[model samples]
Target: MPIIYRIAASIFLLLTTIPFVNGQIFEHPKQQLINADSLRAEYDKAPYFGLYKDNYFIFGTSLNHKPSKENTNVKFQVSIQQKLTKSTLPGGTYLYLYYTQKVFWNVLEESLPMKDLNFNPGIGIAKPLFHKGRYIGKFSFQIEHESNGRDSIQSRSWNKISFGGNILLENNWLIHAKFWIPIVDGENNKDLLKYKGIFQIGTQFMTNDNRWKFGLLLVKRKDWKPNFNIIGEIKYRFSRKADWSIFLQYYNGYGEDLLNYKMFKSQLRAGIVITPPMFSDY
Candidate 1:
């Protein structure tokens, strides 16, 4: 084995043998275990920042259109959330502030100009859902704004009110459903709902061993007619001790990019993803 691989293997072994988190032999299992002490350590810290969405960098090209500078590019997204208050507020909900940004880098084009930059920020509250004293899921509501940082005719911006939650279903399936009310007026995106969709619903399935995961998302456009955006992803973890995974994703439909929200496109992307312990972190 190469020197780097040998060193990583040694570290993984050592870390797994150390019972530093919740008396578990391997820290990876800690992603599924959370206790009072862990809660305090996470929520009571000086800076309570955690991952809000899956983060990744990908390089790919269009599957429907012929590959070219306009079709081949690199894409990336970074998302994070900060806990505004350590304790629950009047409604038994935790306050959170969030930010998520995405960039479409036209690496294949000459001069390598970026296609667009979508900036999203929001404030929200989350409440854990319980059924018959058993923890079932979580619900959240937020007021969010999304804009592509551009000047004049290139700029696209909108604000919306969103509410959604995750439910733990039978087996290894988890479902997430979110609905939004667009507040478009002077943003120059008055007809955004025709393509942006009124709501999004997705589900994920994970293997028992945690090595593989599959997911799908569907977005229904606002028009009374049939219009939808479909996305699917499958990811595999190379090692049990790591959070990173090899990711493959397919995007088909409109609204993939804020700058070209009306165009319909299809693409296949391959990349590496860092899976966050969003559920356990809380």
Candidate 2:
């Protein structure tokens, strides 16, 4: 079996065992359901685990720029966030630590060559926006570092401060936008701004029952003239209670990966998305 299959099997086994363990801890079936609901509610209210900003896993493929050859590859991302402070700040602010790793694999190659690995770690603060209800959503500010874990000529790294927000609309529409400010000019990634740009915006439309979702993301950069990248995605839940969902993604333009940041490419892929996007809950 392939390594990806093995990893997926392990994760599925762990997920299946969680319910059995929880059931053993509870004396009665009714008590188990009650406790489970209570725990879930508490988790929902916890910082860094809320909707939109929650952690997720993604596995997919990229067609690359070559279609009639072995240029297509496997892609995956694992992301997580942890709450750093239980106590709220003066204005009800919450602090969090976040990390995400994305990788591309040339599984078809003889040696199973891994193409690129992008590691991102950040600290962020989130606060309620507007009237504190879902009307205006939430605002977040973060400083992040991203690198390819390479050295010398192959090194690619940068630091960015970002301001972002999640907006939930009454019609089951969700919007997320983020603006980035590069902090340091790393020797290997000095021209990153010309390709990555200053900001990105995404919006999603979800079904009322939260079973189906579609979203689009736009990334822009202005060097001599404006350049743009667009990503489109659609997802379907297996069931209301399931933690996994099927996802289809399409991308056009540049900056899909740090190694090929400046290369414009178009691709279509499909995989699983661990959790629903933020502001998807109604």
* Top lDDT model: 1
Question: Model 1 Cα displacement at 210 (Å)?
Answer: 1.2
Name the runs in model 1 displaced over 4 angstroms: 1-47, 131-134, 279-282
For model 1, how many clashes? 0
lDDT of each: 0.72, 0.65
Output the TM-score of candidate 1.
0.83
lDDT of 2 by residue, 97-199 (tens): 8777777777667787778888888988877553322234567899899988888888888999999887756556778888878875568777887777778
Instruction: Put down candidate 1 lDDT per residue, 140-246, tens digits, no spaces.
Output: 99999999978788789899999999876643677898998888752667788888789988988877666788889899998787768998989888766776679
Model 2 pairs in collision: 52-278
